[model samples]
Target: MSPVIETNGLVKRYGRFTAVDHVNLSVEKGEVFGLLGPNGSGKTTTILLLLGLTEPTEGEVRVNGLDPLRQPLAVKSRVGYLPDQVGFYDAMTARENLAYTARLAGLRGTDAAGRIITALSRVRLADVADKRVGTFSRGMRQRLGLAEVILKNADIAILDEPTGGLDPQATQELLELIGSLAHEGMTIVLSSHLLSMVQAVCHRVALFNRGRIGLTGRVSDLTSAVLGGAYEVEVEASGADVPAVLGGAEHVTGIAVAGPGLWRVDADADVRPQIARRIVEAGGALKNMSIRRTTLDEVYVRYFQETKNQQEKKDAEAA
Candidate 1:
């Protein structure tokens, strides 16, 4: 099947500066895709291009099999967007806000009312339906924004920083709702700086840096590819010589003293047995040890830094 969303050689520029470089992307139907980056990294620009909010400087975009640039209205009708800064009329009630959107989306009377009620309930905002948006909290407003999307019955949902600024409880609830929506067959494009939330809901992610896509793939696949054959071990040994003891352990690549009696070791594989033996033989009492896979944050940081270093090297060479 063709992609639900596809962009080829996508580029966007402002005056002399390019905000979005050539980015080729394909998001399959029913998949929860994530766009991860810091501020000014062009994630939002890509979304705008896809929604026809802004025209691309070059290349082509297709959403649900139609060109967004050529068929803006059709594309907009099928795509629902919730930006990082979601806005609602302060004087309007939650239901009123969504009702207005429903009418704009072409639903009216009993049909619109039914969808409005269902949408509010889906986001767990039914109790506050009649309450004014001015009285609602940030999380409540965010959920109400989601209800507006549901009322539109959009085939594709685009969310930018959906959980930004929410408390722990609210974040968890919102993330769960996002997951449920994908399960119900909506193609989702989630743009977020929150790594843990992306790790939880996104089946795949593209890392944006300096207007370019530096990494893109399944989260686990990206981790394995970037952190090949690496493992982090935390050992608590009761001796100042802990690092010295594990320095010569099998497959041990690097070791650092995290704190008193705490050491972090990196190796090609499970070197715990060798590490344990080395520490014991060196007369250091081992308190505890644990090993785990490298995290997404670690891989993300390393990728951008490595790319930056490589670019600097090229600039030096050109000079």
Candidate 2:
């Protein structure tokens, strides 16, 4: 099946500055795809281009087989967008805000009214239906924004930084809501810098660095088997001799000193038995030895940093 969202050599520029450079992205139907990046890393720009909020300087983008630039209405009708920030009328009640949004999306009469109620309930905002939005706390406002988008029952939803500022409870609620929506067959694409949340909610994620699609795939796939197993070997003694002695052990690829008397050893495979014998022979006081492996954070950093370095080299050569 064709991807619900696809980009071909997508590029967006502001004068001499390229905001999004040659990004190719595809999100399959009913998949919760994540876009990960820091500020100015093209997350927002990509969203805008995909939604036709801004026309790209070069390349093309498609949503559900239609070019957004050519079929804005068709695309817009099928999409629900929760931007990085949401602004709502201070005086309008939660129910009123959703009702207005539903109308704009082409719903009318009781259908719109019922959807308004159902949407509020979905985000756990049913009890706040009568409360004015201005009086709502930051977290509540975030939920209200969510209510507005999902009320339309759009086929694809783009949630930008949906949990950026919410407290723990609110963040968990929103993440749960996103996960539930995906399970219900809505194609969800979200952008977030929060690593933990992405690992929790997204089945597939693309890491963006320096305006390019640096890495993309299932989180498990990226970190799997690649770790080959690792370990943290902490020696209470602070001496260069420890590393010198531990360095010759089989399956030991690299040793990084995290702090004084703290060292992390990367094993080619599970080699705890060999490591223990080696450390003991070195006369090292092995305070702790645990077989640990790579984490998503570590894998993400490794891939992102490598991509950044390669980009720098290319820029230098072009200059």
Of the candidates shown, which would achieve the greatest TM-score relative to the real structure? 1
Distance (Å) between predicted and true CA of 289, model 1?
Answer: 2.8
lDDT of 1: 0.88
**Ten-residue stretch with the least lDDT total in model 1:** 221-230
For model 1, the stretches where C-alpha displacement exceeds 4 angstroms are: 235-271, 277-288
lDDT digits (tens) for residues 17-59 of candidate 2: 8889999999999999999978889999999999998999999
Candidate number with greatest lDDT = 1
Clashing pairs in 2: none
- After superposition on all C-alphas, the RMSD of every candidate to the true structure, in Å, is 2.9, 3.1
Name the TM-score of candidate 2: 0.87
